[model samples]
Structures are given as structure tokens and as C-alpha cells.
Target: MSAAQLVLDLALTVRHDGRGGVADDLEDAEGLTAWVAAHTAELAEAAALPDPLAPFTADPAALTAVRDLRRAVRTLFARAVRPAPPSPADAERLLPADEALDRLAAAAARVPVAPRLTWPEPGPAELTYRPAAPAPPVDLLVSGLARAAAAFLASDDRDRLRACHAPRCVRYFLKEHPRQEWCKPSCGNRARVARHQRRHRADAL
Candidate 1:
């Protein structure tokens, strides 16, 4: 997936109220590890890192750090999607993006990158690329996710970012279609149903 999509995917793992609510998937290190394991393929493809499983650091502290970064990214994306300023409480979270990016840059610096030539697809498909030395898995993961966010934030598509407004929803989606408002058909239906219920209540009062 593209960097934007990657970051978006990471930001979307846990629901808006997921930390302590019913949909919280990153509530603990175990859950966070599971989530990382599940996305190994996607993460590997995006980062071009060797050994897809290598990026999942076994350190408990690393797991906690990634979880923290994920939440920080989600907070940034949520703000980007909003039409107005976030509440003062929400505004407090705006600093995460910077911090996460700084951490990623530091982690990335330690990877010791060098340019190398290789033939990717047999005949006549030679290309040069910068390859990095083996480093802690968490570092690569952080760098990849941070790059995704940085790319997305710098792109024009950031304006198209939207958070599902459906009741009890916390998913973020890119506006693929001009008429696309909700993330999925179910959310649209739920939103319509909610509107109808509100109208009915107001009419009967």
C-alpha cells in the first residue's frame, strides 16, 4: 500500500473509543503485538524490509512504544479530518505527530543505509536502491509508519480525509468517490436511521 494508506491503516486499528471501550484492540501489549503480526505482510511490502517477521520487536517496551505511536497518529489523522478546531482536550494530542516523527527519524538514522544495485525481475529489470543494515524491528516499523503519516500529511489527498460520522463509529476513510460520505454502506444506513429516529422523536414531542 502507499504511505498514506499505510498510515491510515495504522491509525485505524483501534476505534475512536477503543482504548477502554468495546472496540479497543490496542488495549495492551499482547493485543498490539497481535495487530502488528497481522499486518506483517502489508508492513513488509510498504517498507521493502527483508524478512517480514523481523520488524516485530520482542521487547515489551518496544511494543508499548509502537502502541503509543499508533494512538498519536490516530489523533493527528482525526484532527486532519475535522472541519473545525478540536476541543481543548483534543488539542492536547496534536503534539503526537511531531514527537512520533522525531522518534522515527532518530530510529531511521541508526539503520545505516547504503545504495546497492540489483535485478528484481530477471532480464532487463535492473535497478539501484538504498538498502539499510539490519536494525531492531521496532525501529523499522516506526520509520515506516512515520513516513506514511508524513507523506499523507504532505499530500493533496489530506484534504479528502474523513472520519465516519455514523453513531458509535470511529473509522477513518479516504473519500474515494465524490458522493462517498460514510466509510461503508452499513454506516450510511445507520446514519440515515439515526436521522429518521431523531426526526420522529421531534415530531411526536
Candidate 2:
């Protein structure tokens, strides 16, 4: 894939602003670990590159390094996904990988791109817009991660982010208003109905 497409896919996989909060599905540490494994494989395949260690013959060492970097990213993802006591294995798995991703991100920032117009010019304006260079891969990845983290960290009551409280719905959302609940109202209604039915059954007894 082209560099742009790889960047876009990485953003989608890491941030996951889909109709449903697929990111939240991998809520716990183990889930996060599993998610990284699954997504890394998909990404590598989508890029049409051979295993991270193959297809880049100019520098076999660099290919191995990139593969290790990817592994590190997976480790960070697992840590971010879970909230649990850290074990020795988890610590060992995480630190080097996290450092590698950070370094890789820094290096990726050096790749340049041509600037494009942000908006169409009005008539006779001479198209006087100068585009800025594109951000490095590290910046894109980090920025996307920040957005996703904010969505998860912000509270629903604060009018920032939200998670569907329905038993059957596992989605996260950005609430448009203070009272907003689920990504869709139907999910909220279903949850309410389920709650009501449970209460009524208990009352009948």
C-alpha cells in the first residue's frame, strides 16, 4: 500500500471511530493483547509486504527492526487496553516495545509530503493558499491515539465521551449533549425496557 493508505489504516485500527466502539470491546488487558495480535496481522497483510522481516531486501536488519517496532506497538496497545496490576512478564513485554514505538514514531516524522489546499478559493482570488508539509507517521499515530484516549477518558456527564450502558450494546460515543446516552437511541430504549421488565418481574414475586 502507499504510505498514505498505511497511515490511514493505522489511524483506523488504533483509533476506531466506527459506528460501534470496537476499541472498547477489547476492554481488559488480555483483550488488548489479543487485539494487537489480530490488528498487526491484518495491517501487515493489507500492506502487501511480506512478513515484516521480508520484502525489504536492501536492509534485512532494518526490516527486523521494523518488525520489532511493530511488536512494541502491540505491547503498548495491550497496556492501554487493560487496567490491572502489572506482572513481571507484562512489564518485561511492555517497556522495550513502548520505547521502540516512540523512537520509530520520531523517525517516521521526518518523511515529507506535499501540502494541499484546505478549502476551495473564492472566484478570482488567485488560489493563494500554501499547503504545509504532511506530518510524520509517528505524529499521525500519536495524534490518533490521543483522540482515542480522550474519547475513553472523558466522562459522559462532562459532555465529552460516552459508552453505551445497554447490556447488549458495547459501544463508545462522543455525546453531543449532556443528556446523550447511547450512540443510537434505540440501544438506550432497549436497555430501559430490559431494566423495566426486570423490575416488574421482581415486583410480581
Candidate 3:
């Protein structure tokens, strides 16, 4: 995944539970491990994270750090959407904007980065900065997530970020088109059903 996508996906980890409530994918070690496995390859490639000899396992501390970053990310996503409601998972208790920004900045700073020059046999030379030697898997992951969030927020795509408010769904998504409403067809269907139910109840009244 591109860095932009990582931030959005991280914020969306808090989503609709099958039983109609909020569920957090980072609630425990198992869930966090699974989520990282699923997204790690793409993100690692994008961020130049080191490949591990054994599969990466998330520990309690990693879980706390990642969840902390997610809160900040969600808070910023809420701010990006302006007057529109944010995803309901933590809408009522989002971190303060300044705090959220600080969290992201701190996570990204955990790893030291230095600029290096690169030249290809067939390409022109370019100067680029790579993250210095690998940190612990969890630290690198969190730092990468924070960096991705910062990049996304500073890019044009941030303007398209939005919260999905369909029944039982709490997600943030990009606006694909002018008429796009919910995050997907299913959410749109649910929203229509909800609208219909509201109208029917109103008519009976």
C-alpha cells in the first residue's frame, strides 16, 4: 500500500461489528498480529521496512502504541471532514487536534532518518532520505504509520477524505466521485433502508 492508504486503513480499523456495534481490530495481540500480517508486506515495501526472519508478533506495548496512533489519525480524519460527523467509534471523544498532531510527529520521530544520494546505472542521480537502520518491528510499524498519516494529511487527497455514517458502519473513505455517498454499495443500501424506515415511521405518526 502507498503511505496515504496506510493511514486511511489504520483509522478504519475501528469499524462495524457484525453484531451492530463498534469493533477494534487492535484490541489484542492476536488481532493486532493478524492485522499487521495482512497489511505489512505492502506497507513494508512502501516504507522500506526490513524483512523479519520470523513472522512479526505484536506484543502488548506495540498494541498500545498503534492504538494510540490510530486515535490521533482518526481525530485528524474527523477534522478533515469539517462539519460532517466523524466515524462514530470515537467521535465524542476524539483527541484534541494539537495533541493528535503531536502524537503523529512523535511517533514518526522515534526513528532517525538521514539523507543519502542515489544514482542508477540507467537513471539520473537523485538525493533521497531513507529511514536509518531498522528499529523494533513495532516501533518501525508505528513510525511508518505516523509518517504515512503526515504525508496523507499534507497531500491533495486529504480533501477527499470523508466519514461513512451508514447504519452500524463507522469508516473513513475517499470520495471517488461527485455523487458518491457512502463508502461502498452495501453502506449505501443500508443508508437507503434506514431512510425508508424513518419515512415510514414518520408517515404512521
Clashes of each: 0, 0, 0
Which clashing pairs does model 2 show? Answer: none
Give residue 109's lDDT in candidate 3 (0 to 100): 88
State the weakest 10-residue window (summed lDDT) of model 1. Answer: 84-93
| Candidate 1 vs 3: which has more TM-score | 3
If the candidates were sorted by their TM-score against the true structure, best first, what order would they fall in?
3, 1, 2
Best by TM-score: 3
* Tens digits of lDDT, candidate 3, 151-191: 88999999999888888888899998999989999999999
Model 2 Cα RMSD, 1 decimal: 11.5
> Residue 106, candidate 1: how far off, in angstroms?
4.6
Question: How do the predictions measure up, each by TM-score?
Answer: 0.77, 0.34, 0.92
Candidate 2 stretches greater than 4 Å from native: 1-159
Strongest candidate by lDDT: 3
- Which pairs clash inside model 3? none
Which TM-score value belongs to model 1? 0.77
Candidate 2, residue 13: how far the Cα is off, in Å: 8.0
